[model samples]
Target: MALDEAMLELAAGGSTLLRFYGWEPWCLSLGRHQTAPNRLLGSSPDDLRPGVDAVRRPTGGRSVFHGPEITYALACPARAWGGPRAVLQAVHRALAEGLRAVGVPLDTVQSADAEAGFAAARISAASCFRDPAPGELTARGRKLVGSAQCRRRGGVLQHGSILLEDKQHLGDLAGRDIEPRGSAPAGVSGRGPAIGLNELLDPVPDPRLIVERLTDHVARAFGSPAAAATSASAGIATSAALTRLATGYERVHRSGAWLWRRERPLPAA
Candidate 1:
């Protein structure tokens, strides 16, 4: 979350970045404007599932339980990617191309009205995985990818999660107090019925290989002559400037005050 925000500085300089990562010990991430359940927030490890915690993501979307999943973030100018919806389709199409390379029959949902679908999702769903807004990948008619975007300082950062396992993670929604999101209209979203890679393939492909294919496809999608991978922490942790900026964002990510609302701004790098 911290580094993704820090990369906005590089993005402002006209650099495009595609990052694939995962959560260690797993986590429940809330969208920029989303709310976390009171019981779940600040709960001890014993009070919740093992090896689980929570944080507010720099991007916008509903809460997602990230485990046995691959998370990707793309940061660049909105114009470079066309727009949020254009970026969404391009990234998802790149992901589909990678899945096809690995022999997974991928399906995509294209909403008759994407903007309308997402607008409805903002109020109707509590989980990004709950609905396939439009242009999301799917398997067996169930959602496979979920994403959202947030623009800061003329740079757009889009974050997405690709589920790799079928485990149901009712993380923040385990409490009985929260009401169900309920069903959407026949054509409406909010009932994605997500599936994982394992369910679509006899044996799931290696995570590194998935990352590589995704990188290549995305680079091609964005018209890169040659795509090269970088260490996740190459500049994020080593560069003093980025380190300081990331630290500030980290403070905001962990700050309880900013969890329910997006009052804190992303400190400039």
Candidate 2:
């Protein structure tokens, strides 16, 4: 979350950033404004472990269960990408191309109300695995990709998740009882209810391969060279910053006191 905020600020200052990350043991992440009261009832805070943990993103979007999913984060000046929608479409096209190269037929989503986009909750109307919208990837009208963005200082950080598996613990994540039916389309099954390269091809395609291909495609889209880096040096510096930010946000978010900060008016006494 701090990274996203920081990236947005940096992007506004004209710096570009992209990051890929993973979820361990699975976790459900909520959006900044999502209500957890309903979902938290009947659920113990301790119950979240191994595969269960809820953290709210500072971004405006719905909750997403992460595991066996490919997550990407990009922060850039809006001017560079033309605009939010155009950048989104470009990235989706690149991903579609990579999936197609591996025999996964892909298509971009078009909202029912194209003029006015769907709400974040509506994206969850069916399931992230089955819902689709502009710049999203889908198969037979089911959602295969979902993304959200935060604009800051004239720049934006658009981060999102790509399902490698479709139905894993999604129902539980949304507090629903629906079950995923049938086999998922290619390139993304098994990981959720869908299968991944690990199970689709004879010689499993390396995750590195997918990342490399997508990076190349993104480079072409942005007309810039892509480079890979590790955190050996920069990672440590960033980690310290993240730690401090997380501590501060946690106090504000986890403490009931903070929630009521704006609720009461000052006493004139």
Candidate 3:
């Protein structure tokens, strides 16, 4: 999360940084403004599950369990993408094309189709995968990619998840109704319907192929070039600006107080 934020802070004027990653021992991450969970459904969250950790995202969206999914984050200049809405759609559109290239049959959720149930679901669902927001990538009618966006300075940081071949088994999170989802390759917990690439293609295509396609398409669509920097220690992230930015974000993510919403503001420096 901190490194993704550092990328946002240091993104060059016209380029986008795409990051694909996973959690280290698995964790539950909350949206920036999401409250700490009172009661979590399905398996025990960090509160009940000893040793596992939880943290808050720097972006907005509902809570998401980090295991059982492939996550992507993009840090790009907002103006280049024409702001948040454009940022969301352009990326999803690009990703849809890329996924289709690999046989995923992905589609962008039309705003009109998404509006009807959005309000109720938005308030009631506790997981980001619970409903497809306008511009998210979906397959058949279930979300194939669930994303959320937040803008900072002149840049945009969007975070999303791609589910795997089986039902995420959300342990039936609270406050939602569940009907068994339709079809195979992907399933919903009490959360919502989402498809995984493995379900569509047995053994799931190598994630690298999917990411490679996503990189080429999004870079071209945004008129930007792509670069690879594997880690904060090994790449441009070592620069002073990113190191400083990462420090603050790292502090937030590491704080149990911040994670559970018991944080006290640091004294003015």
Give the Cα error of residue 169 in candidate 2, in Å: 4.2
Point out where model 2 deviates above 4 Å: 41-51, 108-115, 118-127, 168-204, 225-269
lDDT order, best first, reads 1, 3, 2
* Candidate no. 1 TM-score: 0.81
RMSD in Å for model 1: 6.1
For model 3, the local distance difference test gives 0.62
State TM-scores per candidate: 0.81, 0.69, 0.77
Total residue pair clashes for candidate 1: 0
Candidate 2, 59: how far from true, in Å? 2.5
TM-score of 2: 0.69
The candidate maximizing TM-score is 1
Where model 3 places Cα greater than 4 Å from the true spot, the runs are: 11-15, 39-49, 107-125, 175-192, 225-240, 262-269
lDDT of 1 at 222: 79
Clashes of each: 0, 14, 1
Candidate 3 lDDT, tens digit per residue, 22-88? 5565566677767776453336333433343566777766766665566777788888767766777
